[model samples]
Target: MGNINKDNLLYMAKYSAFNPYRMREREMGYTTSIGSSDALAKSLYCGMKAIATWDSDREKAPPTGGIFNLEFSPEGTLLVAACEKKSIQIFDPLTHERIHAVNGAHTDCVNCVKFLDARMFATCSDDTTIALWDVRNLKKKIRTLLGHSKWVKNIEFSVKDKLLVTSGLDGSIYTWDINSYTEYNLVYQRVFHTSSLMRCRLSPDARQMVLCTTGGLIVIIHDLNLATLAQDLHGFKPNLYRLMQMSHQMIPVAAMYDHLFDSKNRENRVEFVSDFPEGNDAEVVSALQVHPQGWSALSRNISHDDKSEWTCIHDIQPMESPCDKDTRDTSPVGRGRRTPSRRTRPRVYRVPRPMHPNPMATTHIQITRESERAAAGPSTSHQGGAPISPPQPSRLGLPGIQNDVWEAAITIKQHRLLQEMYNRGADVPSTSGYTPHQESPYTSDEEPAAKHFIRQNKNRLLYYIEETNEGKGFIKELCYSSDGRIVCSPFGRGMRLLALNSDCGELSGVAQDLSQPRLMVELGQSLGIHTDLVVSSKFSPRYHMLVTGCLEGKIVWYQPFSGESL
Candidate 1:
């Protein structure tokens, strides 16, 4: 409609339904009756041009092994990969050059790797331990956490709480206090799943956690901090009275529950949110990830041949009302007749009978001679008795009974003196007579009272992509883009990108009419360079590049917009 420039021409070529070639042919007076398939051909050509491509010259080679996982540092300065040969490789994303390779990083295969901060990262291995490393000095190990009895599968770091959450094949999830790198403490441990835990993901806010088990179970935990729950319940009518009552009965058992559940110890904290039904054809989930915008992506095998894998995107929807039922029964106050008990008469509640009668009290009296009492102090003696000799100064000179009586009297006097001093605001030391110990650095300070209750919606599955010819392989990993607009998974030598319908802020509303959604597949131009299956892939949070590593120890970086190999 306006003056066409080079940029407009290129845009029209890529996006317009009319093919640029067809338009040019039409301008040249080419006949439209050449074939009825012209319109379909034009659409196909447009779709082909829209597929992203990559440059082939940016491939990097590392010592050979399958790359299990890829992660970018929070600052996006370094890229790291966990390998199956007990090694870790670091690369520079911009140059596609190998930076450092830590050979023999673990005794067994390194299953997962995650960046804790800019300079720190953690790795889990089949050796049943998690090792922390410092990028600044990789010559020596930073620390090793030993607790899981089986192979560790996943590791996640909570930056806000300075905690490390690790899941193992033993079905246990362990939380560690990472405040002290050299001396980390196990803060909490629980058997969260019956089967082996496949993966664990912490939400962007670090307030929720999602875990997937090999048994096709998914568990979602909300309000990871009691303070967060306390704040969220500020105006929640249903939970207000319950939480208030819980605060009053904050006994040792309740504290234990809080530590285990990470909330007010209520049943709502941990939810058995969803699970693939038994006897269904759904495949076991192999990888799971939570988007920054509260959505989630999971990859599951759909067929027995292991060739068909599906990646499902889900939108989290909050319930209109609380899912929990009120603990109090209001039926008695409603307009309904109550049924009588089976017994003819109501049974009275009573305490259990005692086993035995109480023991009789025993009293002992001690009599001191008048001569011995007058000497202990300057108090007046009885008028009829002679002046008593001063009490012996040493216990060795007194009788056994007299010594015992005198010691009891002295102890009673000290107790009275201490109590009086305490009442008078004096500095009364502890009866145990031990100096107070300093608080440990790993201990958390009292969390501030939450101003409002944090509410989370249930996640709803939006759409799923089954295996196609271009996306055939066992899905090794799934990742979400920083903006939550796209989810990418590497299959075989190529990667599939699924664009979520996020025109609206929430994804749940766009569940319908998802037919023919945008999808992009990037297969490198190198003929045999990436013949092996891609084991790991990740999108840079700060850049437009996507990095992938394959089983043959080849790494490829791609620029999504131009599909140019970086």
Candidate 2:
């Protein structure tokens, strides 16, 4: 038994390309690289349970027809399993007590299992159908989904839990409104290709769905509410009556831009004005503005579209360069790609534009600097030619010009405030130099050393990186409690738990190992210094206590706190 944070393990997979050493260790099946400590064991070892992964030598010389799919329920109590044994088994997760068994549920092998709710569960099989069952009344069958003409490969419930989608060997995806069990009454179904749909998922909001096909094409489907379409089409439904009938039309845009800005300004002299608009050079708007006086707008003096016959539209003076930070400038709140849905969350994004060239080279500012005003200039004189008192300069450095003048929309004060924050380490880049740190999971390295890439906040290291791996695999399943008191590393192969050593800001060294540590799915909750998790064997979602599931289709339930294998 060894203890280690699951994040560290997933980190290894994420940065495997960059950090060859750590990845090599992972490939060599090195579990518990962080070393074992008693404190970690006591904290993480809530109970014992069965677990499983793909047989290491599945396609090798010695082929063992064993278990493949393994999962635990949302409550982490019961484990549900589909194994090569062609049977589903139930047992005490901690004590390994054999509770019940369903021998030969399918002609071939069981593929996967999912909990519909707390009491109902669903299982798919190589037999090409999904069977819904009432787990509490195991002898009865709730329903059987039979749309797939071939073996069903996967199934998932919608976010709202009203719809269930399934894909399989037939290269088609089918969605069913569970409440309306009619076969032809399918809500949505599409034949993607001759190849199978390997996986699919509904978005968190249930507005859209995505599909990953074996043919390598990612298909996106837009679902429309019939009521909304009816209202827009005929106006029969009033007061939001047509929302349920509306259809979404996808339109392609050639270009898009976003800009975000803080309302506060600290710089007095220099400021940001506006962004350039889209168009040919002939009609391109070179300047933009946020000012009321129109002093920040830029109008080109000459049109460059006709090289032979140049025309001046307008011109102005130039100043220092502007600040550039991608996070504050370009990126949205969530990393997800945005769509044109009005219901989507509103965000502030900055539209980027090129800075002006040196206005010193221009004759406008050059003339003012060397004009007679540079010498005697003009004095405050009355009609009698008698010198009068000159008023103090305006707080803003706007010069008095007879014709017109262009100034930054951002005041000098705003620019100065941003600079102050930059100098004070308010927003700093993680890496200082040109080193290409691991910013992506697909990069050829494990996560970069925490010191080089992560932001340290007192006792915690926080960062988010993307992964190229398919559906919530090894690293994707892990999550931490807000207080950092518990760690759940639910890998596709297995799950691990670790205790947070609050005093040392390090992980304790004790751990518990199941048969297939890689197949365990983990989740945790914290009450105090203790965070509890339930591990189950196979696909059993029901757990009265500490339950476990094995990839071989076995499950167990026990009382981990009392050390009783019930």
Candidate 3:
């Protein structure tokens, strides 16, 4: 009670309607649900229950500073942590017991660690070298591989190809052939290179690979070839857009679908990611930017917090496109110049000034009368003077007649359309014998394309306030559970285990709608599960166990199953 300040006390007291203890009971999982008595068993459990902690005794070991990365072994029997103290420590994940220690694992800070198998694993450091080690013998080093010219940032293993893949700040992807390693000559192949490589991973299926960079680009390599992109990236030609170079004249080019090589199945053309103009946030981004990423025109962002500005990014839509306006806003025009809700807005899609208009045939022409038929009669194939259709605007305009496009001429009277919906077609009412009006003028403006909002709002959630951080906060990483149910992340000082919503409620479980992800915390004013900044975390794949390390070099173990080890 004494630790609670006036503002915090007032914050907790804002909800004067309910009893505090009862709310805590439900939040701590001490109160049973209103259903069958079977739910009562869950009441005994407190979520994210702390099992034990890993910290060095001041006299026994040299002090460790901050924790950088954590990894669990493939067999789930051991865990490794890379530390800011320039050393590596091994711990029993379930018991949180320190099993082995190496004082100087690297010349500089250890950044990342991964297990190749149960007994053998690897670690990388700022010294630009990757060291392999055997768990059985911690004192002696196995072998250190040196190929990266800059700090190695990530490590991944391909079991199918029997290869060791690593990416570094040097922007090169190296694959070390494990079967052919020699002390004198290192056998590694450089597969791909980019400007700012930061992370790399092989797909679980071993069919594809991906690399992430600092400039917010994900390079997906299919068929493992650098010469041409995979056909799978091709999709229907960027909806009503032309690919163009961002140059002085903005020269237009053929859709990149099959233009790279002789592979010419132009059924699904695509636009490139570099096409979208950068924006402050997703809301203001142009919809045409959705083509390259195959989703929304989202990029870097900075969200408004309680006070300061922090970066924000949105969820991706894999196979759908999001609209800048409501679907109902697509009406041609509103009644009596009241301004239609769908009056085309310039922000939805920005066609580069030099880019060509959509590849559509601008106009159509028809024979006006029998006299206009060509002298080659048999080729015209006019059978017994069948009723001729009315003449359409000619494809080309001669000096005397102008080919024009009219803004969808309404067929019915304005009074008749008050409660009725009408079908619109290309046939002009003026051509169908209504009193012909003056020929319309030709304009350069193209009609806007109709886009739809996603059916579920869950897919388009925009987060604010909660994800803000500072300094090394950008380097801190979070991950989903092995089964992808819970999100384990380091919030400001402590860490949070957020569970996904399973119920189908309109407001997502409805008691106190924080408008944020479901946080698994004990009831009351306790914000998270710790008091110091948690800098790194790792999860066990075969069990419901989580381990995190703080800036003070204290490692905390989180487990749901109490009293026993998995």
Candidate 4:
């Protein structure tokens, strides 16, 4: 089996454009080419292109409402979309064919859709409910979760803990255990935010969360691990009131920023380190997306006009750089770049010592004599020989050895006097000695006061889109590929892809020509589906495929790398 896997890997390296080993080598600064042809070709492989489009039947008066969300199965086999109407559609990504459509899934518009596993998925609706459905049996819904009193805006599932977290417009957040498919039990609830909750997302490690509100507030809650909470607090249950009280002392350290209301008080406000020029008018941040690598993209309304939306991407400088070494040998000489030297034959030698007498042996001798006396019959004299006095103390009575060759050495008479005083438990005669508080004989200069340095944040903005569609269309969603190579967004009537640029440390278009700043895959223009706007887009987990949905009720599949329809 191991040999077979190795053979498969070798075959992929030889035939496929995606080369994992080559990418790693380039990242480590070991590549010999400085912008060579091969390097450019490898970079092109990371770029994206549109391939196919699947449009809804226009004559059927298809739901004119736009798609609100798009999600793909864990295996990338099926794609699902939540439409503005009370409907949920599933399509085969490989064939670009609609396999299932559930009409009247909810009483109101479906807002978000997410796949729990390969065979099960969940959708949230404006009807204040969440419905779970099995892909095999789309006609029959699996379960309905009821807790939020208002429109459910967002839902997220933690695969590690099998818990689903949902937020609603009623200013409440709830957590449900999905381990039992038949019964969805609410595990946690909180109503800490005063305004309506717009969205909630768990961090990549599931240790923190980022939440956005309709009032333009962004809140980050740290240390949100359920296991950590259960272990630290005794008899703790998932209740809103208890969690709110415990939040005052323990987990869920929160940081909030209300850019819209607090812009005038910049000095006292918690400002994110950004380089983008702040608009004269305050912008209401509506959505936030954070990448696993600490980068973030925020969508906001920069103007008074309702449709004047903007998206900005920021790069957070990591506390530690990737080049930091964990070992003492940071020199690259013996690293993978060079071969290690062979070990030579061992050589034997005799050990040499005697820098000073062992103090431990001297103490042991004294102990042995005392023990022998105790074991022997009571006698005034020593057991081994004549009565022996304790070793005489020198005039220079320090803790360790005294310098015998120096003129400061004590004479024999002085040593006898000191030994007698010690035996009698009397203080010895005073002598001159060095003290830390005393002035030095060599110099009179005073030491300098300690100095402290403050470090400033270096976070900067990588890219900004002020008017993606002439201030007409709003950004619906933002997604980063699983490999972190590309970031996609549904701007207007199409989708845009941004590739990471190594030179400028920003996301730029794939086209070399920069005259046109907007380089997007125009779905409407390419597919001739110009009736409505494209609203939702998502990337596959394991492939280069992308699925996009439009307001005209069309689900289009595209091969981003090859421009070849599947």
Taking the candidates one at a time, how many backbone clashes does each contain? Answer: 18, 88, 0, 0
lDDT of 3 by residue, 55-164 (tens): 77633677666677888998789989888777898988867788888889998778788898989998987676788899999897787776665556678787767778
lDDT for 127 (candidate 3): 73
Give per-residue CA lDDT, model 4, range 1-566, as digits (tens): 99987864454344334545665666788744433432333344344555656655533545626677888898888888887778887778887777877889988778888887889888998677888899888877877776655567788887657778787655455666765432233334342332324567766656555665333334444445644332232221112111112122111211111221132321212222322323412123445566644345444433333445556554432233233122112222112221111113211111111123333221111111111111111122111332222233223322111121111123323444544454454554446753433543423232111111111123334555553543232336667665555566665666666544432123323323433223222112133433456666787887777677776666666663644533
Count clashing pairs, candidate 4. Answer: 0
lDDT of each: 0.50, 0.33, 0.45, 0.48
Worst 10 residues of 1 by lDDT: 361-370
Relative to the unseen true structure, what is the Cα RMSD of model 2?
Answer: 29.4
Question: Model 1 Cα displacement at 280 (Å)?
Answer: 6.9
Better of 3 and 4 by lDDT: 4
How well is each residue in 1-566 modelled by candidate 2, as lDDT tens digits?
13466654554444332334654766888774343222233333444332322222332322212333444555654555564445554433444444555666666566666676766777777566677776687764576555554446567676554767676544445555667544332233332322223444444344434443211123233342222322222211110111100111110110010111111221111112111111112211111111111111112111122221111111111222244232121322112333212223322211112223233222111112111111121221112222222223233322122101111112223434544444343553445643233243322322122111111001001111111221111102232322233343322234344333321122212112211111112223222111112112222223323323333222223222433222
RMSD of candidate 3 to the truth, in angstroms, is 20.2
What lDDT score is found at residue 21 in candidate 4?
Answer: 67
lDDT at 298, model 1? 52
Model 1 spans > 4 angstroms off: 1-62, 181-188, 191-193, 226-268, 273-280, 301-307, 322-459, 468-475, 501-529, 561-566
Q: Model 4 — TM-score against the truth? A: 0.55
Candidate 3, poorest ten consecutive residues by summed lDDT = 399-408
Q: How far out, in Å, is residue 125 in model 4? A: 0.6
